[model samples]
Target: MNTAGIGGTDATGTSLRRLADALGTEMMWAGARDRPIGEVVIAEPGDVLADLPGALVLAVGARGADAITVVRSAAEAGAAAVAVRAAPGEDGALTPQVKAAAERAGIALMGIAASVRWDRAEADIRGVLERGAADGTSGHRGDLFSLAQTVATLTRGVVSIEDAAHRVLAYSDSGDEADELRRRSILGRTCPEPYLAHLRQWGVYRRARTGEEVVDVEELPEMGARRRMVIGINAAGRPLGTVWVQEGTRGLAGRTEEVMRGAARLAASQLVDHWFQGDPGARLPSRAGLAHGLLTGRFNSGALAAHLGIAPNASATVVAFDLREPESGDAVSQDARRAEAAEIISVHAASYRRSAMVAQACGQVYAMLPERAAAPSSEGLLTRWAEDLVSALRHHLRTPVQAVVAGTAPRLDDIPAVKLRGHHGLQVLARTPERQVATHTALTASLMVRDVLGLLDRHSEIRHPGLDVLARHDDAHGTEMCRSLLLYLDAFGDVGRVAKDLNVHPNTLRYRVRKAVALAGLDLDDPEHRIAAMLQLRLSREEPGTSPFPGG
Candidate 1:
């Protein structure tokens, strides 16, 4: 049959011989090579009597079995053909009885090379069947098929288009000059192993993921190809796939690049359309986009709540996860890692009955969870939930994940501010020792002081009188009196703990605290004065200038 006859003009069905050839296998005994195969099946032992009319049956584990009985049973079951794995270097593996049974029953018998993986063989046969069906119905006029043919005709080179995962979606079949690599890739419906290795070695996958529009490979070793060009098909800055053209001995012209780019754009549209048609929401803005709008205060509370399926006045908490990768990792690996982490988080969050709208933004995955109105204590529950999530993520991913839980927002409109607070918690945690979970409340004082210092015009103005006095005394005397006082107050006057934290003797720390209080003229016994001193001390560390207190 001609190429057009095999995949174009014919409409009956794919023949047994065509299926075997597509799999790169041969018929052991050709009973009826022209018989049309309607479907493919992988049959196990004792399944020979299964109803598989007009289907090509692959009998796995057929070695050392009763071949005659299996073949006759398949034929009785209305199978078009039966294929068995051939033992290496054993040409006469199929017994005479098996051949006679196949011939008498009018069933085609085929032998697949032991070296061919069953999965690849099955995929190849499926591809052939799909092409045959398309041709029989539409006759070389399908969008993807026509695009492939056009690319080949224009460049006079082999063409293949693959999705991001390297699965072959379409390819042009140029008759005689098609190389071995192209043949294998097209038949298996995926890139060949050796070629994938080569691409990885040259960092092609990394460059493709970095949003590069055009990538040129000067040479592909051992493929008998001179050069190749790869064009990335993208939508909304995310890479969809790539179009690859292999230049043969006849080099491509200057205009070939421009033409290929145009073709790539068409292919991208087709891919995106297919994706949207498959999943209706893909055409709409993604959850990430919505979350970003909320974070940037771009959407009103009512609209955002309606979209998120929450009440306008509902309280919510933002849980942010920072998925870190090694500095040496490439962009491709980093993206894969992040995606894996996000999927795990989504699954776990659902299991907890916390239906979260997860989104990726600012190098973190944010899950905005609505708090139940009747819950007694939302913050405590949220903190504990974050701790559990961090533990689960670490156990599954085998890497440390930092989780920051923001305080509950009073209403949906306050989510943007709460998200900012969550990020601030993350920043504070970064300066401390390694921790799995950090809540906004634990760092409230630090955050408040940082916020105040950020607005100060100059560092020379002291925020509190007592803190200023201690600061000057420490600077002049070259002593850690200010540090001792802050630690003493932070510990709630627990001298032993404060001394240990400061790495100093308890008596020394106590003396410094008393001397510092006396020098600053502060009364530590009064609740109001102690609160005022703590606030001033916290602010002093952030900025060396004026006290925020009204009076000395």
Candidate 2:
């Protein structure tokens, strides 16, 4: 945890003045402006008593008299200050009783914005506490949140860090200058779908997610989105996230991009470090667990939907992410890379959609997009988001990340089937690497072929027994009959091509082909036999040492 409060270092700790600046929007309820805060404690609504001397108590889930009771107890505990949520837009005007309690107990009181989430508030306070104790000075802490503040100051704009998926990570406070879009995003802990859609419509997300140069966004009045300047954060050619500077009530400062570019590089390093070490204090992975449950049908979709704050029957946009790696790569490194990709997707999912859930299943990362209770048009929005996600992952992972959309599942029960389609869609994409993102509907023909190949791969009884007989003949005699026959069929009986391909004589190829047919009692003239042979041979390529009979 980082230290709490800023500036005016004291024998106890930093003063409240520095603390208020550390928390850009926290107002004074009744606290001494110079109260020294040495530590920060998270107070449960009813239980605030502890040996919390010189600590700033953040009373969670408490309001009015309930919060005042904690303040009284904290003061008795010798706490330096207690910060409570103020009524929205009213500062501490309605908390006179709370203030009176603090005054009587000789304890300082502080008012954090009601709109500020308790968890987020605690995070900010923790940053101040952890950093302050390290330096024993400056209220300012060197963390992502403080960096957000520094970026905001340099650009004279509201600043935030967003991953390639457009999820806002830690954003700075712009007070009254913040627009409705930023306010709602902070309040809900995600950017609104409609607003993100608006940005995508103008290709703003593309340039921001893919490139390192600063990209500008004009005000989108239709969506109530303010202008924003986006610069991609990159390290070693892999995107970490983006540094976003939004125009507040004030215009941006001069030479903003020059300073922002350097800050962006620093942010990328910090982000990469954070990914490697991670925050122990981050919220539990309940959302991910619920998502995994939904993907694997381990939990009732209705219940999971309720937990994720989605409607009971909302449609799910299922997209599967597959990380491309070498076939012979170390298994440990491959698993590690997959885990890293999952982490990258999961972090962005938190702030990308209020209900977005990412889970790993069958060695692939699956994201259940924001379940939309609205019209079906929202699927288009989700699709666009998925496309951008693929692009972002390519930049961040620096690998061929194949994403397959399974289309929208109208019912929760159908999501598993949809997930299967996405899984198969990835298989179809594996055969065609020319494109990275594809819809299941777009590859129907290819998927059908895959299904046929899968049948041959899975059920050996349905295969022509002749092929197995022919393969045994080759294994026993060291002959190339089956290989010649496969080549002959592949070339449509073009003897010259087959012989040249094998560096064998044309007469030798024909003799071997005839011998393979005779040994297996194979009917080369039958179209069905030829088609089955072609597919089975293709499947054999996937199974080493088992050619002429796949999955044998």
Candidate 3:
């Protein structure tokens, strides 16, 4: 079958790596990650594939043993890739035979996640090819509302798009013909949980989640809900924040199915763009495993790099960010807030570096700026670009953001050590919010201090006895003993500066300091006591939610 993509390996050709990276690893696991596929064709159940070089042949409805046959035939047909689908619980990785077929025949095998509609996967893959041909610029990117409007026009029904959690992302303009469910979902941006429970109770959600078929859910008279057809939007197993589409119209099931199926694919393309381009919340958990592994040094670097389409030997810069939310904002989920910051950074990253990839882990979002080996040393350039990212985030989010740009170009194998350095820098930034952006090189002293603080955190027994008397006294008496003492200690007994900062006479500050020292039972005359007292105060300030990667 012809797809709205290239028919040969020419201008529209896309590498398997690009496809996997664009749509995410959840879409398909390739036997080989490097082959270029220009065309997408769906194979009937019994078709003997032949003479289809550079084609991504979708073995639709072919599973188990039949899928194995399609793999072998794809090898004979000179296809660039053969895709097969699997349900949620099935093993979808490449088999030994499939691997051999690809190795010998230069045809990679693709294992499509069960929940993904074949049409969606095809559109997603073809989108990768067409977009690549257009110099990585997509004409129809990130427009779900328009897509929803088109689906409404085709199905003659009111349509709405919601994430799997039932948060409505977009909807089509509609008249009173729209059901109450559609109206509520669009207005509230959430579906009623009880009605969703009914979908689960009748296995409607499961069918929508696991199948490409548009689920026909009849009206629940008891609940006063009207009839609607729904489909689950998933790129892969991780659910990608899950997409749930609803159509509320009558007498068009047979015809609407095909149109809705096409709509699902188009929506998948847009969501995939959101997922990769900037929507950190979508399918993040599914992709987070590998990202976390690579960032934390827990996973095999080479394998993770290949899976992420990262070149192991490529020199790369990793930027760490800490987005401190404003004091007050509307009630939004943490994921939503994180995505907002990440989306802004992602926009800057994409514009600055074509090879940049963004992911979230350690309660922080990271942008991996991949640099080619032969590229000029991006010493000053990367830092400047990162500064722009921080500025953009600050302006757009109206939040204080600290961005730490790693100076050393670390390859995959060095990621753990590099991530550690940046992680320490972030921890330091959590305490010092004055600096907007700091380089890893400049954060050396702060990073060490932060590391020592971490040791105290891990070994609670090593934690110092804080200034309990002074803190409690200030709390009760409305005094500023703790603040005065910390400012005095931080200034190295600079009484004038501390007094000016406190907006008080120097002698008044001196009196308060003396009283604080006496009350806290600390000897200010001794240097050891001064340093120990400062450490104690700093440690005391290290409370919950203060760390950069808090609860990471």
What total of clashing residue pairs does each candidate reach? 10, 15, 2
* Backbone clashes in model 3, listed as residue pairs: 164-242, 240-283
* TM-score for all models, in order of appearance: 0.47, 0.49, 0.44
lDDT of 2 by residue, 1-552 (tens): 112222223455766777777777556556576777765666656673767667788776678677878888888887888878777544333367778888889988877776777656765765665566556343222345656765675568998776555555667777778787877665434577898777788886667656456888899876677888888787666777777888987788665665466557546645664445443122224555767788888888887776666788788778888987767658888886776677555434533553556788888998776566565535456567667657666875688898887787887767788898989888767765667788787878777876787777688777677777877777798877766777788788999987998999899888888887787777878998888777765665555534233222
Lowest-lDDT window of 10 residues in candidate 2? 1-10
Q: Which pairs of residues collide in model 1?
A: 461-545, 461-546, 462-545, 462-546, 462-547, 463-546, 463-547, 463-548, 464-547, 464-548
Question: Which portions of model 3 miss their true places by more than 4 Å?
Answer: 1-293, 296-299, 304-310, 326-344, 372-380, 397-399, 407-409, 420-424, 431-434, 454-482, 515-525, 541-552
Model 3: what TM-score? 0.44
Give the lowest summed-lDDT range of ten residues in model 1. Answer: 1-10
The stretch of ten residues in a row with the least summed lDDT in candidate 3 is 1-10
Instruction: Give the local distance difference test score of model 3.
Output: 0.65
Give a tens-digit lDDT track for model 1, residues 1-552: 000111222226687777667656343546888778765566556653666667777666665455566677789888788877766455334656567777999899887667766645664665677777655432222445556655665566778888777766677765665666766665455676788888899877777666535678777557744477888777787777788887766766444565466566556655675545342123223445775677656888778777655667677778888754456648777776676666555544433433355666666777777766566246677778778767756765677788888777777778788888887777666554368888888878767766665555355464667668788988898998877887788778899988887898999998998898898888898887787676666556653433332111
What local distance difference test score does each model get? 0.66, 0.69, 0.65
lDDT of 1: 0.66
Residue-level lDDT tens digits of model 3 in 1-552? 322223235434678778778987666564677777766666756876777777778877776666777777877877777887745545433556555655666667777776786646655665566567556322332245455655565456777776555666656666666666765554334676788788779987677777566787888767656767777666665343333334454544334565565556445635665555553323333355676677677877787766666677876678888787654546466566676666555545644654455677766788767777677345577777677668756765677888887655557767667766777678666666777888888878766766676676677676334477677888899998877888888888899988988899999999998899989888888888886677666766655765422112
Instruction: Choose the strongest candidate by lDDT.
Output: 2
